[model samples]
Target: MRRALHAAPEILANFVAPYGVYEMLAAHWGDTDALIASAVPPLLWSFYELAKTRRVDAISVVVVSAILLTVGATFMGGSARLIQMRDAMVTGVVGVMFLATLGMKKPMIFYLARATVARGTADGAAEYELVWERPGVPQVFRVLTLVWGLGLVVQTSCMCWLAWIWPIGRFLLLSPFISFGIFGLLMFWSLGYIARRPAARAILAR
Candidate 1:
C-alpha cells in the first residue's frame, strides 16, 4: 500500500501530466476522452488486484467504493481539494463498514486475516474457522474492529481538515505521508498487541 501510494505521483507525472500520454491525447482528443482513458486502467487494475484474493465480500466493497470515488472525482472536475475529500470519503466509508461489522457474525479484520491466510497457506481457511470460534476470539476482534473503525474516522477527519486549510499542492504531497504514518503506527501497535495476546499467539503457534 505504501509503495503504491508513493508511486502514484510519479505515475501521474509520467503518464497524465503535461506532455505525458494522457495530456498529449487530451491536447488533441479533449479532456473527457483523456480522463476516461487515464482513469479506467487504474480502476481496472485496482479491481484486478483485489480479484486475485479469495476474500470476495470485503474485497468487493473496497474495489466498488474505490471505483465509485474514482468516477466521482473524474466527473467532479479537477479540484485538488475535492479530490482529497473523495479519498477521505473512501476512508470514511471503509471505517463505517468496519464498525457495522461489529453486529455481524465476524468483524472485518477476521475476514481479512482469514482470507489472507486462506489464500497464502494450504488448509489454512479451515483452521481459521476453528480458531475463530475459540473462547475470547470474537471479543478481541470486536474490540479491534471498533478501534480501527474509529481510527479510520479520525484519520479521515484529519485529512479533511488539512484539505480545508492547506494548499492543494502541499496537501496532496503531505496527506499521503500523514496517512502512511498513521498506518505505520497502527501496524506497530497491532503487532505489539498480537504479540502479547494469548489468543493471537495461540492461533499463530498452530
Candidate 2:
C-alpha cells in the first residue's frame, strides 16, 4: 500500500496528464491556440518536477523534455489529427531508438532497466553493472528490447490508425488503455522469459 501510494504521482503523470489536458481543452476552449496554450503549462510543470527530483534518471528527463517539445510542435502547427498523430510519434521515436541501439554493446533496454531498477542506490547500481557483464545476460535484454521496440511500434501504428479513423474523444479515451495493456503484456512476457533463463535467473537472484 505504501509503495502504491509512493508511485501514484508518477503513475498519474504518465497515464493521466495528457489526457486530462486534452479533455479540459476540448471542454472549455474550442480555439486551437487556446488549446495549445493550456497544454503548455502542465507539461512545463512536469518538466520542472522532473528536473527538481533528485532520484529521477537521466532518461526520464530526456523523455519528458522530448514530450514537451513534441507537444509544442504538434499544437503550434498540427491539425487535430496531426496533434494526435504526433503524440503517437513520441512512442514511435522510442521504438526507433530501441532498434537503433540493438547493434551496440548494450541494447536500449539495458540502459532503461538499469535506470529503472538501479537508480540512486550504490548497491543496486553495482548489481546492475555486474548483471550486464554476465554471459548471455545482454542477449536476454537484447531479445526483450527487440520485443519492446516492436511492440511500441505496433502500438503507434494502431494509434495512428485510430486517430485517422476514429472520433477524437473516443481515441483519446481508448489510446492510453491500449498502450498500457500492450506494454503490460510485453512486460509480463519479458519478465517470465528472463526468469526462465539460467544466466538471467542467476543475476536476478543476487
Candidate 3:
C-alpha cells in the first residue's frame, strides 16, 4: 500500500497530467504545440526522479527516450492526425528495442522485472539479481520479452491503421482506451504465464 502511494505521483505525471495539459492547451496552442507541451510534466518528473535517486534504469531510459521521440515527431508539423500517429511510432520503437535486446546476455524483460521486484531498494535489487541466476529464469524472461515485443508491434500497427482511417478527434478520443486495453491484456497474459512457471513462481515467492 505504501509502495502504491509512492507510485501515484509518477502515474499521474505520466498518464493523467499529460492528457490534462493537452486538453487545457489544445484550443489555444493547436494540436501540434499542445502535444509537444503535454510532454513537459512527465519529462520534468522523470528528471526529478533521476536527480533524486541518482540512478538510471532501463525503464527511465525508455520513458525519457519515448517522450523525446514523441516531442520530436510533433516538430515535423503535419496534420493533427500526424501528431496523433506519433504515439504509435513511439510504441513501435520501444517494441523494436525490446526485440533488439534478444541479442544481449539478458533480455529487456529482465531489467523491467527486476525494477518491479526490487522497488528501488539496493538490497532488494541485489536479491532480484540473484534470482536471475536460478534455473530456467533466464529463458522465462526471454520468452516474455519476445511476447511483449511482438505484442507492442501488433498494437502499434493497429493504432496506425486506426489513425489513418478515423477522424483526428475520434482517434484521439479512442486511442487511450485502445492502448490501455491492449496493454492490460498483455499484462494479464504475462501474469498468468509467470504464475504457471515454477521458476517464475520462485521469484514471486521472494
> What 10-residue stretch in candidate 2 is worst by lDDT?
30-39
Off by over 4 Å in 3: 1-55
Superposed by TM-score, candidate 1 places the C-alpha of residue 176 at a distance from the truth, in angstroms, of 1.3
- Judged by TM-score relative to the true structure, which candidate is superior, 1 or 3? 3
Give the number of the best model, judged by lDDT: 3
Spell out the clash pairs found in candidate 1. Answer: none
Taking the tens digit of each residue's C-alpha lDDT, what string does model 3 give over 46-160? 6787778665676667777887787677677777667767767889999999999999998988887676666656577778888888888888888889999999999999999
Summed backbone clashes in each candidate are 0, 0, 0
Note each model's CA RMSD in angstroms: 5.2, 3.2, 3.4
Candidate models: Cα lDDT each: 0.68, 0.73, 0.80
Rank by lDDT (best first): 3, 2, 1
Provide the global lDDT of candidate 2 against the true structure.
0.73
Per-residue lDDT of candidate 2, residues 1-206 (tens digit): 99999777765665566566667677666534433543454466667677676565647855775676677566656577777777777788888878888999888777777776665566775678778778888789889879988988998899889888987667765777888898899988987998888778644443
lDDT of 1 by residue, 1-206 (tens): 99999878655543334224444565676644554455555566566666666365555566677678767766676554565576567777788889998999888888776766666567877778887777877777787788888888889899888977985445644565788788788777777777777876544533
TM-scores, one per candidate: 0.72, 0.79, 0.79
